[model samples]
Target: MTTLLSVQDLAVARGLRTLEGVSFALAEGQAIILRGPNGLGKTTLLRTLAGLQPVAAGQVVHEPSALAYAGHADGLKSALSVTENLRFWAGVFGRTEVGPAIERMNLSNLAARPAHMLSAGQKRRLGLARLLVTGRKVWLLDEPTVSLDTQSVALFAGVLRDHLGAGGAALIATHIDLGLPEGRILDLTPFRADPARKAPRGDGPVGFNEAFA
Candidate 1:
């Protein structure tokens, strides 16, 4: 039940678009579902949490070894086999074991298959499997179920449950219901940037404010 991450009054921005007034704390074994309409900065928020991008303001506090991120783009090498990709990530993350992760993802049979040869669902599964190799405490996931089927989605849910069962937390930005047994939902609509403030011309797409304005 320890707090793994704390984001206080955070503001995440992309070009002229900004999402402000964000605050949340993620505890061990807890999951937070980030729910918001498109272009409300859900992805941007995840990026900010992952430290892959800068936050315009406020504070993000988390241990360096406690965070792992999985974005829309699966971090996989197309030229490598499934095992090879996992092995590479294991090496990068300084994890000595890869067998359990492969088994956990149900990718044992496809171990020798090149990533490019796998179907979309299989590839997505592999992408998710990489999260386990890092052994990080907090997972920042963006649309983790993009191309998964019913079975694959179920597998993912089980994986998430197991991760939580092991005292790891996740912040998932997804529109689909993941069927997690326990978690909290965080809606970001209230955090939309001020409408009165004009953004630079063509800085980004019109958001909640501009659409109404």
Candidate 2:
């Protein structure tokens, strides 16, 4: 696999330090489970990588087109139908169709239903389906299993495994087991209190290009 992203001395904060001195690399097709107690900056890191948050210091080298990042509470618009939301995401990511993303998330039957009409698990699936709209090689996810039932979670794991098999990389932060084959693990709590303050909390950071070792 080739290097997909590189992160060095990353840090995130929220008025106070959330985490610091973080460094890692990521390659294509690898998956790493990021573990940490609440408030260790796990979620913060994912958001920062997604470009949703600002970075304080350090370089995050990456192939620009090869990334997709998602976070918990990324609810679909309640008034919109599943297909509508998917269309919106596809447009945002410049994807042509929502076919594979919908199928992989098991959302075919509910495709026409309004977002608010769906159950918790179904909604989560809809949210995750957005990932498929991007032709990205790197995925940064936070609490990807928040509302998924056991079966749906299993299905998601299967899809995620396939994503890796296809030369994609994933960095997931979750309190639950993700069941990814050949997946590595990282505990973000050890570098917080913000222990090891290197960069500002709640900001910009780099993606890892060789983090799976």
TM-score top scorer: 1
**How does each model score on TM-score?**
0.91, 0.88
Model 1, span 1-213: residue lDDT tens: 799999999877777546888999999999999998998889888876776666677899988789888888777889999999989888878987888989998999999999999999999999999998998989888899999998888889999999999999999998778888778999999999985555444443223221000
By summed lDDT, which 10 consecutive residues of candidate 1 come out lowest?
204-213
Runs of candidate 2 with Cα error greater than 4 angstroms are: 193-213
**Which digits, one per residue and each the tens of the lDDT, describe model 2 over residues 1-213?**
688888898766644567667888888778888987776778777776766667655667888677787776755789999989888878877877888788889889988899999998898889888888877778888888888899998998998898899888999998788777668988887767533444444444444421210
Q: What stretches of model 1 exceed 4 Å from their correct place?
A: 195-213
Task: Score candidate 2 by TM-score against the native.
Answer: 0.88
Best by lDDT: 1
TM-score of model 1 (CA atoms): 0.91
Error of 1 at 31 (Å): 0.4
- When summed lDDT is taken over every stretch of 10 residues in candidate 2, the lowest stretch is 204-213
